[model samples]
Target: MLTTLSRIVKSGWLNFWRNRWLSSSAISIMGLTIFVTTSLLLINVLTNSLVQILRDKIDISVYFNLETTEEQILETRKSLIDLEEVESVEYVSQEEALEKFEEKHQDNQLLMQSIQELDDNPLEASLNIKAGTASQYEQIVDFLNGSQYKEIIDKINYRQNQAVIARLSSITAVLQRSGVVVSIILALMAVLITFNTIRLAIYSSREEINVMKLVGAGHWHIRGPFIVEGAFYGLVAAVIVLIIFYPVLWLLSPKMTAFLPGSDLFYFFRINFWQILLLQIAVGVSLGVASSLVAIRRYLRD
Candidate 1:
């Protein structure tokens, strides 16, 4: 079995190098396919990360009446945390809220003057609620409104922030869906190109193939070399892409971080290195082997 396998591999290598131009063309196309596939996967990961970041950053602030005390707010915060959908609830006292507002507006002379003229801290004591998902915010608001302490809750800022949340969720959802569709279309085109390239390469060797068949060579023996060649194309392409991909990732990490404040593309890439390599191999080998098999089957049918 080992000897047969070795012969098959040797024959595949010879077949690959014999038609240098055709094999090179196939390898190049397969390389591009792997490249595109890997890039799309990264974009998909980043899209998910961006969506999650936006969700994590956006939360609803529940402002209370002036009469509401810090203890009451803290009590409400405790209840909010007990809810399954609530990821966290932060209580901000009126004094602290006012300080934050003043600090934020310190650069504006008019706003600072207006704030300074106030007899007391005008900001309301509040609880900021962060839910597990975009869809759960409404449920949290409903809970706050109907709770035993509802009378103390002056307002939940859901109305003011709902549009922004919905818009961000919608955009991210659209981006994720569109990315999948585009990736599929591009991958199909790549596969089609591969299939056709191998088919044409096989067509040129039809006479040799027919002569071999006349010698009563079994189907496996006849088809083994082409299959091996196809796998080789995928294998080599994957290696070439990895060599190019890692360095490119290292170079782009800093720039990506600057463009996106919370993103660490390099870290993600590094952590997922083995997964990425395996994915490349799976895609490359599948594309190559499938294309070769289909092409050979067609030629055999004649």
Candidate 2:
């Protein structure tokens, strides 16, 4: 068994080396396909990160009446935290709110003077409620509108930001679906191109194949080399992609960081280097082997 496997591998390598030019095109295309696949994976990661950042920014700010007490606000926060849809409920005291307002308007002298002139803090205590998902915001707002808390509650800001949240949800869904679809389409194109290249290889080696069949060689013995050749294409392409990715990501990292401030593409690549390499190799080799198997089917039937 081991000898047969070695022979198949050796023959596959010979075939690959013999038709290096043909293999070159296949490898190039396979590399491009893998590159695109990696790009899409990274893009999806970035999209999810951006989405989470947006989600973190958004939350239901329930401002309480100026007369509302700390105890009442704490009770309301506890109630909100108990709800299944609510992820968290953070209570902001009036003093904290006043401090934040002043810090935000410190550059504005008129606003600074107006705040100093006030006898007491006019800022209201508020509860910032974050939900598990965008759709849950409405339910949370409804919960806050309950009669028990209605008198002390000044207003819920969810309604004001409802449209923006809804749009964000829609956009996220669309982007995820679109990424999957585009990946599949590109993969299929890679397979088809590799299949055709392998078919041409089989055609070029037809005379040798016939001689092997005349000697009563088994079907797998005949097909194994082609399969190995396909895998070689994938393997080489994966390596090329891995090498190309390093420089590309290194260059883009600083630029992307400049544009998005906190985004570090190079750092992300470095952290996931091994995982990315494995994924690229797996995808490249699978596409190659699958394409070769399908391509040689017609010839093998004889």
User: What tens-digit string does per-residue lDDT give for candidate 1 at 81-130?
Assistant: 99999998888888889889988888999989988898988888888888
Model 2: how far is 60 from its true place, Å?
2.2
Per-residue lDDT of candidate 2, residues 71-174 (tens digit)? 99998888888999999888899999999998899999999999999998999999998888777898888877864998999989888999988887777677
Model 1 / residue 292 / CA error / Å: 1.5
Off by over 4 Å in 1: 69-71, 106-121
Q: What's the CA error at residue 189 for candidate 2, in Å? A: 2.8
Q: Measured by TM-score, how close is model 2 to the native structure? A: 0.92
The worst-scoring run of ten residues by lDDT in candidate 1 lies at: 293-302
Q: Highest TM-score, which number?
A: 2
| Residue 155 miss distance in model 1 (angstroms) | 1.3
TM-score per prediction, in order, is 0.87, 0.92
How many steric overlaps does candidate 1 have? 0
Model 1 scores a C-alpha lDDT of: 0.85
Misplaced by over 4 Å in model 2 are: none
